[model samples]
Target: MAGLYVYSVLVVLLLTCGAVMATKENDQIIKENNCETKMGLPCFLEAFTSIFETGSISNKCYVELVVLGKVCRSALVKRTLENPLFKDLRPATIIAKSIQTWNNCLALIDSPSPSA
Candidate 1:
């Protein structure tokens, strides 16, 4: 019974150590990703407000917003996937679609206007 208790305690200690190491690695990744620099909340809010005020923004404006939104979303999705906190969440497909949509919007934005 003493031997079994020792084994169990050792197992628990190992698991705790592993968890701590994983958390440290995740923190390093988060720091490297520079979440704040990549997605400034104030900038996003300002852009959103501008879009809302426009009532009916042009395609170019919409495309620009979409590009920024997609970049931000993709970064967050990637960070979440990397972080242990959200490790249980399945791999994301939405980020890929967001990138595709942003690309398509950019193409449209680049194309000449019918009158031009």
Candidate 2:
């Protein structure tokens, strides 16, 4: 439906904004705050890695991500859910969209090759 398209576009914009504004300083802040006190860095990375690998979140991973959202305030999980476009969607649905967006975004990155 037309509503779905608009909603997807909004998700794309929000994800793009989050990715664009990210910098080394922001990464350090996120690590210092969320990784240590709120959530583990490996947990965060694994959630993302699983999303891309599975094309859908596992039940355990979903629970972990929800808990991460609850305990951490500075990360995308909170803001992504708060966006007007996501207000009507279920938490799982929002996460699915975000994961899909993340997969797309990561595809845009050019990985560095090992030096010979």
Candidate 3:
């Protein structure tokens, strides 16, 4: 029950942080800039940390999202979006999934121990 509470709080915190990683418009920007990437857990975590620790999205990251299409692309997403049937919704879905994946990765990253 404690773990579940923590998880729920984490999600709520994430949602309340004004995370700009939402919306179909962002998806379109990501697609237009061709900044999509196939990043592993570590890479995604690092990138997210840089943003979250600063309490906002950095200009470089924002520009990448808006002008360069630098989104967290996955092999699975690539394969699925390749199907023409889902074209209209593909970009937004991939972006949303990538954000979800990154959040999960962030949760698993150990916080620095005070003893250290």
Candidate number of the best TM-score: 1
- Whole-model lDDT, model 1: 0.55
Poorly placed runs, candidate 3 (over 4 Å): 1-73, 109-116
RMSD of 2: 15.7
Worst 10 residues of 3 by lDDT: 61-70
| Sort order, TM-score high to low | 1, 2, 3
TM-score per model over all chains: 0.39, 0.31, 0.26
What are the lDDT scores of the predictions, listed in order?
0.55, 0.54, 0.47
For residue 92, give model 2's deviation from the true position in Å: 19
Over all chains combined, what TM-score does candidate 1 have? Answer: 0.39
Candidates in order: C-alpha RMSD to true structure: 7.9, 15.7, 17.1
Report the Cα lDDT for residue 32, model 2.
Answer: 61
Candidate 1: clashing residue pairs, number = 0
Clashing pairs in 3: 30-69, 33-68, 33-69, 35-69, 35-70
Candidate 1 lDDT by residue in tens digits, 1-116: 99999999999999999867765665565566554454346544543333222233346555545555553545544545556665664554534544554565567777887984
